[model samples]
Target: MSNSLELPSYLEKSAAVSERFKKLHRRPVKLKVEDLSKKFETPKGELVALNQINLEIHRREFITVIGPSGCGKTTLIRILAGLDFPTSGKVKLEGKKMEGPGAERGMVFQDYTLFPWLSVKKNVMFGLEIKGLGSQKAEAEAMEWLEIVGLAKFAEAYPGQLSGGMKQRVAIARSLANRPEILFLDEPFGALDAQTRASMQAYLLKIWQNVDVTVLFVTHDLDEAVYLSDRILVLRANPGEIDELIEVPVPRPRDPGQFLTPEFLATKKRLEELIRPPELAQNEEIPMIRLTEVGDEVE
Candidate 1:
C-alpha cells in the first residue's frame, strides 16, 4: 500500500463524518467568486481575460481549474489570490470582500519561488517571520509543515541543492506553514518531468488531506485535473469563459493504478473532450481577434 494509507486513522473516518465535514465546509462558502471578469486595455481594443466566472469553493476541498493555454486559468487564480484585481465582480472569503494579498491567502507559483539564499527551513519560516511570529514560533511551524510535506529531513538544505520535486515540496510547505485558509497553486508541478509529476501529485494529495486548507489549483494537464480534483472547473478561451464544472466520483485514497480503471478513464475522457479542439479532439480553438500579447491580459 502507498503511504497515503499510512496516514493516521482520523483521515479515514466514517463516510458520515466526512459528509458532516463537507456540509460544515460548504455552509459558510469558504470562498465565493461571483461575476468575476478581468480585461486588459490595449492599443487595438480591450482583451478579455476572464468573463463571468462564478464559483463556490468549500473549505478544505481540492479544486482544480483546467482549460487551454489562454483560457484565463492563471488570471483567475491570480485574482483569487488577490495578486491581481478583476475588472468586474467580487470574490469573498468568509463573507468579507477580498481586496489585496493577505496572510489568509497563500500562493505557490509554477516557478520555484524559494529564496536561493535561504535554507529550506528559513524559506518556510520567512513568511511567518514576516507576519511577526518570531524566530522560535516560526521555526516550529515551518518544521511542522515541512514534516507534513515530507521535507523535514531537508530543512537545512538550500534550494539549489534540492531536486525539482523537493523544491516544490518546500514551496508548498512554505505556503502551508502560514496556516492560510486558502491556498492557490498555479501549476506548481508543471516544471517537473512525468515520473516526478505523478509522484508530486500523490504527495500533494496526501499533504492536502493532512492540512486544513482549501485549494484552487490551475493545471494544463487533463489527467492531473481528473486525478486530484474534487470538482474540476473547465474554462474555454476567447474571452475565457466557464464551460462546465464536473464532479469526480472516485473514492478517496486513490492510487496510481486507479488511473487504468474504467471510472478514471471515463472521467479523463470527459475532461479531454472539454478542453480538446475539434480540429484535434472536439472543435477548433476559438479565434481571438486582436488578442495579441500587447494587452498583458495574459491570453
Candidate 2:
C-alpha cells in the first residue's frame, strides 16, 4: 500500500510566496529602436518598404512580425540583421549604432541555404572557418550546437541526404554557433510540411529556453506566432508600418498543446483581424487587374 502524502499548508504557502516574490523582483528588459526606415530604388522606381518605424524589442524576448505577403516585414528584419541598410533612421544594439552584420547577430534565411556538397558539420563550421577559427575548436563548437538542435547524429550527412526540416535544423545550429546576441529568423519554417513545421517549432522552443538570446522571428502564420512569441507585431502593407502590437499573456515553458486553448485561439483571431486588408472590405467587388503589381509594389 502506498502512503498518501500532501504538503503541509505552511510549506505550500511559503513556496507560493517565494514564487511571487521572485516574480515581483524580476525587472523587465528594454530594447531601444528609433525611427527605423528603409527603401529600395529599382529600375522601375523607388519602393518604400518601411516608413518611420520605431520599436523596442526587449532582451531575451521573442517577437513575431506578421503581415500580408507584400508587407515590409522581411525588409525590416533584413535591416535588423544588417543584411540590408535602411534608407533613413536608425537601428541600434544596446543604444550603439549597428555597423554591419557581426557575430553578435545571426540570421536564418527562408531557404535552408545549406551547402549540398558539405557534410552537416562542415556546413555548420563554414562561418567559423571564414572567421579564421582553428579547425579543432570550430569543429567542437559546431558539433555542440548541432547536438543542441538534435542534429549531431547527422554530422556526416550532406544537405542532399537530409529532409527539409533536418536541413533547417542544421541552419539554425550553424547560426547559433556564433553565439549571436540577437537571432533573426526570416520564415525559417516556410518550406517544411505542416507536420514538420510544427515539430521544428517545438524544437525551437526547447533550444530557446536554454539560450538567453533575443529572437526576432518573421512569420505569416498567426498560430505559429502565438505559440512561439512573447509578443506579436502586426504590420500593414503599402509603406509598411506596425499596425498593432499584441502582448501574449500566456505563461511560458509553453507547450505546443497550448495552441488548443481558447486563450491562444482568441489571440490568433484578434491578430488575424488586425492584419486583415482594409482595401478589400467584407462585401467589396474584386478587381480583375491588380494595377499595383505593375508598379512592382509587392515583393
Candidate 3:
C-alpha cells in the first residue's frame, strides 16, 4: 500500500516493443491467422460468430477491431488472446502455435475485474503473484507499473474508491506489470463518461508509445480507433468476417488535434461506411466532433 514503486533494479527492455517499430518500416507481420472460423451451439440454435477470418497483427501493432453489435469483434480477439478456441483454422504467435493464455498474453476487460477487497497495489500484483513471483519482487513490479500509469499514489485505494477511469487504469497496470507480449483490451474505456473516456484514450496513447506491447482493442467507436490505433481491422456482422484492414496514415506521438483535421474527418467517414451497411447507413448519424486535447496530447 506504499506509494513507492518497488520495480526491479534493472528496467526490463521490451523486445516486443522494439520488434513492433522495426516491422513498421519493414512491414513484416507478427501474428498470423489462417482462415480462422468460430461457431457456437446454444439451446436456441446454432450461432456462427466468425467465418473465414484471416488477418495478421504486426509486432507492437495497435490494431482496433470496430463493428456493429453482434459482429465477431470480441469473439475474434478472445480467440487471439487464447481465451477461446476457433472452430476451424489456426492462430500462431510469431509463427508458433498458440495453445492458450500465457504471460505473453494479458487482457483488460470492459468490467473492472479488480478484487474489490484488495488494495490497488495488491490488485496490480495479482497476476505476478499468480506467476509465482516472490512477495518483494511482485510488490516492486506492481508498484513500478502503477507508477507508470500514474496510480502509484493510489496504491492503497480500493476499486470502489476510484472512478471508472482510474479503475481501468489499474486494470491496465495489472496487465502491464507482467510485461505481456500482447495486451488484449475489450472496450477498456467503454463504461466511462465522455470526458473520462477521452482522457483514458490519451493516456493509453502515451502508454502505447512508451511500451512495446502489442494491443488488440475491440470497440465500436470509430473515432477512438482512429485516434489510438496504428491500424484498424473492420469487421461486418451476420457471420463476422474481416471486411477490411485500414491503416491510419497519421504518425505516432499522434496529435489529438488530428481528430479535427480534414484527414481525420475523411478517415472517420470512410470507417463509417465499412462499419455500417446500406440499411444501417440510412439511420447512422455522424459522431460529434469534439476536438479537445487532455492529459499528454502527444500521440
Give the residue spans of candidate 3 off by over 4 A. Answer: 1-28, 42-45, 279-299
Off by over 4 Å in 1: 1-26, 280-299
TM-score rank, highest first? 1, 3, 2
Worst 10 residues of 2 by lDDT: 4-13
Model 3 lDDT per residue over 185-209, tens place: 9999898999999999999989988
lDDT of 1 by residue, 1-299 (tens): 13322222212435654675566455557899999999999899999999999999887788899998999999999999999999999999988999999889999999989999999999999989999997998999899988888889999999999999999999999998888999999999999999999999999998888777889999998889878887789999978999988766556676877776565666776777678876545457876677455776645
Candidate 1: how many backbone clashes?
A: 4
Candidate 3 lDDT at 11 equals 18
Most accurate candidate by lDDT: 1
lDDT ranking, best first: 1, 3, 2
> Candidate 2 clashing pairs?
none
lDDT of 2 by residue, 101-183 (tens): 78778899889999889999999998898789999999999999998998899999999989999999999998888778789
Counting only residues 3 or more apart in sequence or on different chains, how many pairs clash (N, Cα, C under 3 Å) in candidate 2?
0
lDDT of each: 0.86, 0.82, 0.84
